[model samples]
Target: MTQVEARDSRGTEGSPDPESGTRRARVRRAVGALSRPGPWKRGRLLATPAALLGLLMLLHAHITDRGGLGSLVESMLPWFGVFVPVLLAGALWRRSASAVVALLLPVVVWLSLFGGLLVDKSHAGGDLTLVSHNVGAGNTDPAATARDLTASGADLLALEEITSQARGVYEQELAKTFPHHTVLGTVGLWSKLPLSDTRAVDIQQDVGPLGDAKSDDQKLPYNRALRTTVATDEGPLAVYVAHLGSVRVMPRNGFWTDSRDRNATALAKALATERNERVVLLGDLNGTMDDRAFAGITAQLHSVQDEAGNGFGFSWPAKFPVARIDQILVRGVEPESSWVLPATGSDHLPVAAGISW
Candidate 1:
């Protein structure tokens, strides 16, 4: 064997016959390769899990409701950005340029979906002031609710879930600030300005699910919505105060009653035909503006809080809000500021917004 062959085979001098120097060299090279450490494979493993966590956060937004299975997770959607930035930081720590670059896609996706909200203001437009609330039907202190709502100093007030029994009490309590008022069954509208042509809007319900099925009440009608013309100083404005059907989560039945669905459709139709250019809609929709159930309303009017609200701005269970079922929506009017007021005797907190022409 040649000297080079012997060296390559044994990786040493004079180890044995037929050990060529070339073979010894090859052996030495193999030993050196085995002893050296490799690049960070563990880092690659972690990137996948971190990426998945980000995707799950986005999915949670679609199915989450205050009463739904992912309610808690949904409430936390605002904070997901904090985690996303951290995930990218992990990739940076691992010195994985590919994973780091990969994160930009998710970052872009999240930013596109929610980035607008991160801005300080919702939009730039002429301003109009309005307020909305769901005074509990079972509330015992109608006068107190009125007092609290009046103190909000809103230009227009829209109320919902008012019972027949408490109608007079509310009227008396709010008469000083809102002299112009109208009530259509359980729902009502009150305005600081003069109200004219006030009428009940039939929201496609013959009768809600709670009533007699065989009776005409069971048939869908459009009376669930109410509209009135307010003579503002600038010009006459059309206002709609509607209380869409309430949603429920039952153990045996999933989202049992859909009276609200029919009501929403009817409301949407009515809004579509509204001739007035400047329109304002306020009410307790029994669901969030983001919910697909309220698409009928969302498509027509823009929410004030979603545009300028600082936090989640939950208004239900006034004691501790986790979802904003009540809302103030406006079209052709600009909202300057929006916020939720302190709890009254009702189950929902009063929300108010300031606006200008």
Candidate 2:
């Protein structure tokens, strides 16, 4: 044997294989890698605010309705979903995994509650079509607005905030198509079909907590509401047109003060006692469907747009509708489809609903 050959044999004997040593080095490197702190720590810290906000929004329903603010807030529950996108944008800007995950809480909550409403249930036809608009008291051009409304081809038209000055303009413009119509106070119902039993329903407005008894002369002709029955081919459909008391948010005062709350109660009472089986209430309700004050009405009647519409049919502030204060609520009638019509001269966009049966 050569001198080099003997030395090589000795070095190789009882030592680890090259492949085995390589594996050991790799295991050490992996261990070191696992021990290092990653971005998770920062992600979790940054997600804290979003997590708390999401939790609050998730339980918005259970939030105390002590102040008028809670009910008002719940009216816009779906709007809380807007926060999710904002948070997601922040997460992307900060590159936070946990923040993005935290947003799922509100996203899931909003979708879980209102997901069905987002679906499009519109159909091609319906038995009856109605349009409800709050043609603002200060509408610039009532005749033009009336012309636009008449063009929609609605069978029944309910108009609120119908000022005495503009009433003739609408009546003259709508007279051709809507021959059978009744105007009782600020609200009026114009129908293509015959109407009966039309009267100004006493919503018992809040004159004052302690004041002299108001007589017919002392009170406005129709303070806030009216009811009538329309003779439809389907059957006699009870119709109500109303402009509920306005709600105001003042700096010193609070939201949805007791006046609107009281009017809601009176309106609910009138509706509960309605003699007709099939009824439709159309007007500027001054409150969203989510407002607890309207629970009495909502329990009996459902919003057509909410149950069977493509999207949020916000009708107030025609320029940029944010909330659907104007409403078309129905009972014993199946809503085929619901939608908001294009803006007119009024502050509110006209909302319509088609129903069957």
Best prediction by TM-score: 2
Clashes of each: 42, 0
Model 2 pairs in collision: none
Cα RMSD of all models vs. native, in order, equals: 7.7, 6.4
lDDT winner: 2
> Which stretch of 10 consecutive residues in model 2 shows the poorest summed lDDT?
208-217
Q: What lDDT does model 1 reach?
A: 0.73
**Candidate 2 lDDT, tens digit per residue, 1-357?**
656533332247455577777888999999987886454544665588678766766676677765567777877777877877877887887777778887777777788877877889788689989999999988899989999999998999999998889989999999999989999878899999999999888876553222235332244445579999999877899999988766766454456446667777888899999978999999998888877788888988989988788888888788987888899999999988999999889889999999999
- Tally clashes: model 1: 42
Model 1 over residues 103-144: C-alpha lDDT tens digits? 665676667656766666644433455778788888988898
Ten residues in a row with the worst lDDT in model 1? 208-217
Those runs of model 2 whose alpha carbons end farther than 4 Å from true positions after fitting are 1-39, 207-221
